[model samples]
Target: MMIKELEKLFVRDLEKLRGELDQYPNEETLWKVVDGISNSGGNLVMHLCGNLQHFIGAVLHDTGYVRQRDFEFNGRMDLNQLNEEIGKTIEVIRSYFKDADSETFDGDYPLEVFGYPMSIGYFLIHLQGHLNYHLGQINYHRRILS
Candidate 1:
């Protein structure tokens, strides 16, 4: 039940991010940083994708995925490629959640993201919140930039 809820939120936010990307008027707009913004919507999406792939894919499933944290912000990708990557991230997230069970959720997280020992379930919630926080940023970026 907990996994189900987490999966729902993950998939939903990923899809929402994808949809928001599509709503951007152009690739340039997706990459534009507003005057006061530190990162563009494109950078936020890339960061989110790299983050999940690292924590959930490589760390949890041993998928051998490597995260380039710096490139996630500095990189430039066309909107089509960005959407394709988001699709891959969504698949990875779904695969992990589907295989996870109560014991898995109760197990220790592979890394101490919050500087303390925490359960996988707790970290998953934190990840989801992180995703949503950026999703909101992307939405506002699009609204203002478009």
Candidate 2:
């Protein structure tokens, strides 16, 4: 429940997700548009990176991170680029967690992002869950394509 514990879990989960993503045949393979879906693999990767960056920015610096919400619906990125962005996101998130004090997680700092009231701790947990959910989708798409 502590920040340190949460950080470790986050890192572990991130590594697992990245490993799963690495199993995809290629970036172009991921970019292949699935019929009837609004989002492609590239879009999902960007959205995941953006969300992670947004959470870390909010908690670490109180800065608002700009997310291309609509772009996430129609975007294409190379696998190398997506992997690089994901790596950077993981580093930022890990650093934020490492430096976070107990007070950061103790009090309920309500946020209005996502159009819902969320405590700081709850937000972090939600983001982690979101990442896991998308990672599953990415893996499933890979399996389907392969």
Candidate 3:
């Protein structure tokens, strides 16, 4: 049930991310950072994908995903490519949760993210929180830019 709920939220946010991509008149629009804002929607999407893939796929499931943290903020990805990436990210998270049980979720996380020990479930909540935080930013970014 917990994994279902978490996966639902991640799917929702990924949908929203795709919707934001749809709002852009062109791929270049996704790369625009408004005045005083740092990250574009493109960057945010890359960051979100990289973050989840690294934490969930690599660390938790041993999927060996390598995250380019800097490129997440610097890369210029096409809107279509980003949509594909988000779709893949959703699948990765969904697959992980599909086989996950409470014991696995309750076990210690592979890494001490944020310099503190935390359970996988707690870290996942944190990851979802982080996802929503950036989701909000992307929503606002899309609105303001359009």
Query: Using lDDT as the measure, which candidate wins?
Result: 1
Q: What is the C-alpha lDDT of each candidate?
A: 0.91, 0.73, 0.88
Give candidate 2 misplaced runs (Cα > 4 Å).
62-65, 114-116
lDDT per residue, candidate 2, 5-124, as tens digits? 778766777676678668878666777768765566667778888877776765445556666767665766666777787787778777787667877776565657788775678778
Query: Candidate 3 — number of clashing residue pairs?
Result: 0
Best by TM-score: 1
Q: What is the lDDT of residue 22 in candidate 2?
A: 86
Q: Which sections of candidate 1 miss by over 4 Å?
A: none
Q: In candidate 1, residue 113 scores what lDDT?
A: 86
Residue by residue across 6-78, what tens digits does model 3's lDDT show?
Answer: 8899889888888878987777778998888899999999999999999998888778888999999998788
Off by over 4 Å in 3: none
Q: Cα lDDT for residue 94, model 2?
A: 74
Backbone N/Cα/C clashes per model: 0, 0, 0
The positional error of residue 73 in candidate 2, measured at the CA in angstroms, is: 3.0
Q: What would the per-residue lDDT of candidate 1 be over residues 4-54, giving only the tens digit for each residue? A: 888988999999999999899988899888799999999999999999999
